[model samples]
Target: MAHYARRRCRSACAGKEVSLMKKVHVIGGGLAGPEAALQAAAAGCEVTLYEMRPHRSTEAHQTSDFAELVCSNSLKSESENTAPWLLKQEMRRAGSFLLKEADATAVPAGHALAVDRVEFSRRVAEAIAANPRITVVREEVISLDESGDHITVLATGPLTSPALAAELQRLTGSDQLAFYDSIAPIVDASSIDMEKVYFAARWDKGTADYINCPFTKEEYDTFLDALLTSEKVELKEWEKGQYFEACLPIDELARRGRDTLRFGPMKPAGLTNPKTGRWPYACVQLRQENLRADSYNLVGFQNHIKYGDQAKVLRLIPGLENAKFLRYGQIHRNTYINSPAVLNGTLQLKAHPSIVIAGQLSGVEGYTESIAGGLLGGRFAALLARGEEPVAPPRQSAHGSLLHYITHAEAKHFQPANITFDLLVPLEEELRKKIRDKKERHRLQCERALEAWGAWLAQSALPVG
Candidate 1:
């Protein structure tokens, strides 16, 4: 750790005039941007937060609220010793503003850290409004200010405006990588047929928070056939690319094989049918979407099929035969830069430390991962504003490993990733061979990560929560 810090000291531009500024300009008001503004403010840097919304909206967003969560309400698992949990733990230790809002507005979705997105966004907006150090600007940033005295953090996320994207491409002299991200449909709660579906969480771990749609083998076959024949929303020539496998549209998944949906999102492994007293042939889980509990989204059911075809195919599931959809599954262009070719370990441009790139734009995926990027990027910006060398988190921590993966991955094959045990620094060979239990190995990794994270936070030159 000391060696890495010393290495950083040798190249850091602490004495340069650019690092002496007290101002920070953050573009975008999505999950990562607002968090960056708050963290920079907390570190005593004056922040100008820009959000071009309502007046200039994107394809997927519906509201102008800061930190609006569009894709899904669930923020992944909260089960202890899991990768997501480890990341959130580190964020809590650092006093992340968005995470706090998520906690306050949480609604039941079994063991996952789900929230009422509307309430959560409102709370974050309130925090930004009340903070004296943050000045909100409602407008688009179409061009880069290369000569500004203040440092800039670009966090425009997946749907970055075309002009800003072009400016970034021009600045870096590299074409930003792009992907297709799909979102699932939200169903009206009252329209679901209670008689056909049952309420249960997988393995009956605790309170039943999800509504499970069970299927017999015949039913599953019928649905798959309809899905295979459905009309889909075709991608334009420029917008075409294979989607991230993790978020593949259901029909795209079905094309893999007849049984693909049976094991993928529609898998029935742990969910037991109360009426039959056995597991169904297949199942589709519905997660709560908000605090009101009046709506639920099809879990892992993201699709790009035409809206009418989507309704027809999805309704073939037993309980959804008469279900009313509040929102149909849709796909959007998800844009991001190739981090290894563009960003440093501190998530700043290699040639320009004054410019930091975070959020989905920085190539980290998922809700928590985006916030983690913002948290770290904001702190680094704060350090630079104070004319200090910005330090990267210890590699053992979730924050460190995630940043490391994105910044160190091979440029040609780099893809945005969620926090997973595979991304973390592994245990020594001897330790791995000695402990064969997968769960125990994971626990040890989590323990080691948190300890290192704590030491780094305490020992940083300028500490940030």
Candidate 2:
């Protein structure tokens, strides 16, 4: 299908230079769109990147900045020999623009790669704005042009606006492609009762970057009681049970059991209470919000509780007493398509090869995965615009594994996923038998994936890192 489109584009643009004949239109300036724009420009395509902010705002977005990290600043585990680390390694090999900026604005978050959200977005926006081959448009793209005049990359992350979503549904005849995602609250550093909190990383793994708020059994029980009864923001009928498993709300965890939060987000398994000289019964870890380190967000505290009641409940955490909230936790709808049904291996809409689907909208989850999707969409669209065939990343690589799952998973039961060792193609029986330790197996898989990715990058029509 993509071949036919490539042939048509080649004939239509016949003698004209490929770069001059086409422009790539990337919609949504979230984590994915800017990457797509920058990547397409890097591939010698003229690009128009659209962002609907500072003009029309969404429920969770607070600024006009591009590539904002809305829910969590942390981009999952960065420990070597891990799935998330493999995915990032692949993007770095491909010269991902967003990942480069993320590294520049990184903050100390122990083993995970967390960044100063404000600085990260600012750097990305500056890069997009300064690119000579790209133009930025500050408006929502409610409708798309599929006439093959140009290539379009839809990368509007999880919080894709309603109108555009409806238009997308109209174009593709898709339904039941949304879920409710919650945001965690940020507290002013000055307001925290730090005497009750101490800095420590779990197990002393990487430096003491996290602020640990220790809680006694009595305090945890009291907090649980308040949390279980907190009035939550109501969701529409369709959004009732659609929360993604990895990002469920704090209150929802409370409903599972009396000890769920203690074992889950509030686990104190490895953290020691310095003053008491032992781990507390429970804990709430707060992560720095920005490079300035003036505020911290409650780790794993995404919630849908009503603001008035929510504040009271969250303050029950030991050190959060008298906490002043800079932002309150809330829920918003996250939109995504059934990629297995609608998109091809290269992230192109099957019905419209000129359009590339990406980000959460393309059914992958997490911040890092979204940027990786953008890299694929941008490269595919750029190659297609230049009347060349878009090559799929080798299935052994992390990038290819994600695209493969999204484009080939069982459509009816598919859900957006984050990178995991399980998602990467499993090892052959011989290798699995040889590597008895699971960590060793994972490390080997990540190594092979990088080698495959490196070989693929070497053969690309354009140069990559």
- Note the residue pairs that clash in candidate 1: 94-465
Off by over 4 Å in 2: 1-20, 236-238
| Candidate 1 local lDDT, residue 26 | 96
Clashes of each: 1, 0
lDDT of 1: 0.88
Q: Which is the leading candidate under lDDT? A: 1
* Model 2 lDDT on a 0 to 1 scale: 0.88
Shift in Å, residue 52, candidate 1: 0.9
Candidate 1, which segments miss by more than 4 Å at Cα?
1-20, 461-465
Over 270-292, each residue of candidate 2 has an lDDT whose tens digit, in order, gives: 99988988999999999988899
What tens digits encode model 1's per-residue C-alpha lDDT throughout 1-465? Answer: 221121122335665333234589999999999999999998878999999997799989988999988888888888889999999999998889899999999999888989998899999999999999999999999987765367899999999999999999988888878887867899999999999999998877656899999999999999999999999887787677569878888888999998888889998988999899999999999999999999999988988899999999989988889999999998888999989998888988876667899999999889999998899889888877776678899999999999999999999999999999999989999999999998999999999999999898888755455
* TM-score of model 2 vs. true structure: 0.95
